[model samples]
Target: MAQQQRATETKEALINAAAVVFGRQGYRATTLRDITREAAVTQGALYFHFDSKQELAEEIIRRQHTMSSGAGASFLASTESGLSSIVRLSGELAAQVLTQPVVRAGLRLSTESADDLAGAAAAPYRDWIGACRILLERAAAVGETREGLDLDAAAELVISSFTGAQFVSAALTGSEDLLERLERMWPVLLEGFVRDPDHPVLSSTSDLIYQSADRVA
Candidate 1:
């Protein structure tokens, strides 16, 4: 029992260490030695858990995606209003990108460079677009958006906007300012989505109806 618990802890520690290193150095610049050194574990221990650098990165991506998908799924399930749900989803994701190292690193690795991992690396835009499409459908059904609007296009735009905002913010501020930028981006998104911009159901960056965070995530 002790051996199993210790192994679990060691694997978690190594994964976290790798996320921090990958978050800072990116996949191309990172190495197994660097991760093992950061984790304070022997090379043999790393080999016991992860066979290669790409494998470790894939694990981090998987963990991060799981965490993020949970947040998104929660928003999808709990919200009463479609537009409000969309607003909160953006905030939630932005908050994750800003606060969660695993999420941040996974996003970077999935999108940035993967010639080595090839198709093994994930590009998250399509998944995110699908999630947003669900909310947009809800919003339209609730009369939050214009009737017969191209929801697919809107979802893509929303996904692209979030992606671009993070990429640019990471380049400029290492992503520390992600939520702040998200706060700014929300109003524009709201303007584009709501049925009545003047008297809308919610503000773009208003408090999330769900208990996700303090502000735009």
Candidate 2:
């Protein structure tokens, strides 16, 4: 039992160490020695768990998708209006990008290694967009959005805006201001989509941003 636990811990440590390095250095610039050194494990231990750098990165990407999609699924199951859930979900993801090393690393690796990873890296984006479409559909059913709004276009816009906001925030501030940027982005974007801009849930957007930030603090 102790032997199995130790091996599990070693594997987790390797994944975390690799994520931190990949988040900071990008994949091409990173090497197995760097990850093993970061993990404080021998190359043999790393080899025991993972055969190559790409395998480790793929694991991180898979984890990232799980984390993100898990959150989306939770919001979808909630009683909140879809528009409200969408805002809250964006804040939640922004918080993850700000505080979670694995999420940050996963996002960076997915973008950096798009060509290298082929279609695997794009899975998160596809899932996110699909979730957004479902949310928008719910919003339309609830009259949260303006009538005749194109659900597909709205979902794409929301995801694209979020992707751009996070990318720019990462480049300029290392994602320190991601929540702040999200807090600012949603109101203007929501103005076009919501039936009434002054709705209570819509008005509380900034509060949602702070709420997400406070969770990490």
**Top-TM-score candidate index:** 2
Please name the candidate that would achieve the greatest lDDT relative to the true structure: 2
Instruction: Return the TM-score for each candidate structure.
Output: 0.89, 0.94
Estimate the overall C-alpha local distance difference test score of candidate 2.
Answer: 0.87
Clashes of each: 3, 0
Q: Write the per-residue lDDT of candidate 1 for residues 32-70, one digit (tens) a residue.
A: 889989999999999999899889988888887788788
What lDDT, from 0 to 1, does candidate 1 have? 0.79
Model 1: lDDT of residue 193: 74
lDDT of each: 0.79, 0.87
The residue pairs found clashing in candidate 1 are 91-217, 94-217, 95-217
* Model 1 alpha-carbon drift over 4 Å, by segment: 118-120, 201-206, 209-211, 215-217
What are the RMSDs of all candidates, in order?
2.4, 1.5
For model 2, the superposed segments whose C-alpha errors exceed 4 Å read none
